[model samples]
Target: MATNSTPKKPAADAPAEETAETVTKSAPARPARKSAPGPDVVGPALPAGAEPISVTLAHHHTIDGTDYPPSAKLLVSPDYAQRLRAQGYATPA
Candidate 1:
């Protein structure tokens, strides 16, 4: 004679507990949100006694991988103008 050892039925309350555990395990994690900049958070401020500058920027046209310079005018702050000159960029005489 052979005998079977499997349980005939599971408790009715067992399914509810298993469902809660499954839901917790499958839950998605929430991402952290970044805060937006405030009204006071502007870009870098200019130093004291800094002056505005004005200059002409030569426009260039590219044709067949070659660049040809053209005439153009650019108005900028004096400090920025000096910086450009230091970087070897100057207006035409």
Candidate 2:
């Protein structure tokens, strides 16, 4: 006797569940890291023929979920400063 039999799907009301191990295994990939920069660390690369200037930030700057506190100093040129601000990076004050 041939019969069509298929497994039933879980109910909509039932909350989807997964163990931490499986959750991490199937989680979305981590984002690629940007150039490392810090107060004691080297800042991002300079542009060709662009003059460098040290500027203080006025807002919290976050990169890849890593936050750079406001009022921190960064060495960046004027043009680069605008570009960074556009990207939600530290803005020169």
Candidate with top lDDT is 2
Q: lDDT by residue for model 2 over 3-89, one digit each (tens)?
A: 769878889899668778766666578876454366532245667776777766677665445556677677666676777767656
lDDT of each: 0.46, 0.63
TM-scores, all candidates, are 0.29, 0.42
Error of 1 at 20 (Å): 37
lDDT of 1 by residue, 1-93 (tens): 988998799777674555665667765676554332222211234457764444544444332233334443344456655654565454643
What TM-score would candidate 1 get against the native? 0.29
Instruction: Tell me how far candidate 1 lies from the true structure as C-alpha RMSD in angstroms.
Output: 14.3
